[model samples]
Target: MSPAHAGRPGQAIQIGRDYYEGPLHICDSVTSLLAHYLDLLDRGAYEVGEGDDYIGFVADPYESGFDPELLSGGIPHDVPSGLQAVLIQVNAPRSPLDLTPLAAAHLRRLDLKRRPVTDLTPIRDLPIESLAVSLHDGDLAPLEGHRHLSSLDLATNTTIDLTPLRTAPNLHGLDLSQATVQDLTVLADFPHLRYLALTASQWASLLDENKVPPALAAARLSKRDASRTEALSWAARLGLTVGASFVISGTLTSDSETGRTQ
Candidate 1:
């Protein structure tokens, strides 16, 4: 009933039927999320808990094995007061989620999985260390004040400019695998950025231009069909000098210009 927290990246802990890692890998299934929360509550997991800082809530009528009775009144709006991270995903038509209520000095991470939000203004002042979100309007203007953000994983349905994040001094890791960045050239301005994940085309452009951020220590190219040869070549050109992995191995000519993964 008591699950220890995995404090570092790439580590995982088991909670009920789910595996808990960092904020992003919180319970994914709706049924499992509810069961884990209830079980944790009964075990007093919320009392100065370790990994209980991360919680996930989901309410999707179409989700497999979903039962309405488990959340009769709809998704709970309130979260544990001392919670440090939260993941909320609701598959239904509704207004943007209001984050003002969730803002707290103790909160550090948040994952609003594909849920539209009013804006980033509510949490700008909060000491957020990491964020994973989907921007409906692709506006990053509200991110200027987040000086403590160390990681950001963005999902966009459309192309977006990365210029707004240039001012964040503490940003060390960025994930744009699910986004279409208008200008990856802006990444050069981030002196602290050490890890980056981008589409194949984006990485290729960086290689071609010889503009890979000098501070980068690791990178991930998001292309499903890209051959191991192509990826290794790309990394070599970009001065990555690291081993690369592929989901599915296939031959790819240097002329391949595919950008989007999906």
Candidate 2:
């Protein structure tokens, strides 16, 4: 748990099996249980700070200390300025969500988890550079002219089309660990892509078709299985650095080693 989630009887932050108990009140929410998250923006609690990647918020009562009334009240309508990077994890039923309110100029990174956003038209004009979102099997067509989108991470339970994403001129990194695609040839459309990640099964299908993206600098596989050896061999043949991540006792761990294959 992050420092913000541990609210007190005995305040403790867990770090690699060690717990540090202290007086820390980082919960930015006004109420002990979340009435809404817009209050955090008003209080200037949404900023991720100078060098931090992002400031995260958990909307699931089971996952965090507070209850996010997202079911009763939808996501905040407006994301205030100066909030560069923000990640909100939600637990709710599948429903349409409007993302136009989050299209702030200074907001470079936005991550929405478990969101049932079916349309991307609302965020078509966002100036965000990085986006990690749950697609609800959403189409990537709305991002056609998104020039600043350098990185995109998608979470979907079904296969999605990658043809729409090829329009991004600066797209360098893509994560499709939770998604699948029938046509691996579309990956060649991304001319500037350097990093790619996919599930072991997806990689196998690509390898069998001989359609791995040629310009990739690195690749990561989502699961560990017999297919990993073939992936490593494929990466080696392409002189690319490869890695894999898997769950070990409910803890996420990686077995990635640095340096490119000769």
Candidate 3:
């Protein structure tokens, strides 16, 4: 099989049980990673790969905790329907950094463990044809150069600002839930976005199919349980004017700062 390439932000690339046939591109920054040189890597160690058929990569930091052996070398994650992509989680114990030298390693590259208390730069522009930003159930820092994103899943990352995505003309799918974002004016800027899902109280307002733009077609919104909902109610009560035809799930928070804690 050729080098495995990651999909665009939200698009799916054709793949077999062990191959990803996207645009067949890779990044120069990755091929140079130090992890490429070691014939054998330590579990929870950094990984690397050559560009060849490789499109881009994902960085899940949590994986290091669940499977310490994943860090030893390239970890390929083949999702349902022959879909190949990376699945990185937050940082956990026994995870390494600086994986830029293992040319033989084409990794699933899950886990984004490296997060600073003050800030985190958003992803920058890359040549990736198909990529999946599985920031699901996680928090995302500021994103940078994302010029070639196609399928992006910011789901569960309610705090992330999708405005930067306006630059990604190829974006098709987007998901942001459980995050702190109140409005989705950023999505209105995209002319090509096709599918979107906001399954949280925070970003529910962005699902307005009417005012959200014509490119949008399918969407789903879910809220947390009574033990879950919080500031989202204000948007609904105030009649912020969002989308329709979607069942409202999740909980609504109490009134006042007293409930701020447990």
Candidate 4:
């Protein structure tokens, strides 16, 4: 059976049969969507909607024969121009995935959560507003001139040098949890930053009265061995919300101010 439904706001056009039962079939929803788009491309039907739509698929590149390069070549010839986003889940490593053919001007958002992408030079010149990718041992110099970037997630990367982010003037939110970034001073460059998440290595810098930026309103950190009293005291002094998992508005209660998790 094929999945049938109209695309909605903030929802992606999921094109896979993982949600279905029984063995994996070739003529599943993913294949159907791919075939439909391929047919449109072949017929030169270049008019589609501009309703913030996206297509997500999980398949092997070689076996599925769904080359991502087609997005920059044949797919864009028929599909709507300026497609919102595309999330490709590949089974193999980064060696097999090539994004050189994708045009960044038409793509605004991209999500490559766990993909082993070490080099970001390909999509660096594109106008991406939001991005989420794995940066383990990855170089961030390519992202320096991306002024339109507002949200970024580098939580899984370690020993990352965030000095390049100083050029990104519009960055508002950043995630660096589970990473080993020691310099909290680099964050001062982000004037519009409101939310930040850090690992145990970097969160301790917030304990210093002057280290936490005044523009920050919330922060997430691991409080396992931290002095909860001092951390909360500084957070209250800075008028910021701090937590282990998720940060929310409001100051810590007075009752739990004695080195205890509130």
Total clashing residue pairs per candidate?
0, 0, 61, 0
Candidate 3 local lDDT, residue 17:
54
lDDT measured at residue 16 in model 3 versus the true structure, 0 to 100: 46
Per-model CA lDDT versus the true structure: 0.66, 0.64, 0.42, 0.58
| Native RMSD of candidate 4 (Å) | 13.8
Per-residue lDDT for 1-262 in model 1, tens only? 2332323343322334453434232333446566766776676555443576864334333222222332221234564444455556554554566677665434567777557664777777766788888777647777884677889999877788888788988889999998878888878888889999988888877767667777998888888898879877877777656574547767655534665343
Please provide, for model 3 over 1-262, each residue's C-alpha lDDT reduced to its tens digit, 9 standing for 90 to 100.
2343443343322334554333322322333333432322434344445755532223432222223334333333422222213334444433332323212333332233331221222223233334344343333333334555566544333365556667666677765553455457666777888876664543445444334745766654544453223334534533455444355677677758677632
Cα lDDT for residue 177, model 2? 83
Question: Residue 189: error of model 3 in Å?
Answer: 1.5
User: Please, what are the lDDT tens digits per residue for candidate 4 over residues 1-262?
Assistant: 3322222333224335663312212233456657766765666554444663743333333223333544221223343343545455653444424455455435556666646556778777666667777765677898896877877877445677878887887788788765566476778767778888775556556545256655777776655566767567646655655555445687765555576645
Error of 4 at 78 (Å): 12
Candidate 4 lDDT for residue 7: 25
Candidate 1 residue-wise lDDT at 6: 26
Q: Score residue 90 of candidate 3 by CA lDDT.
A: 43
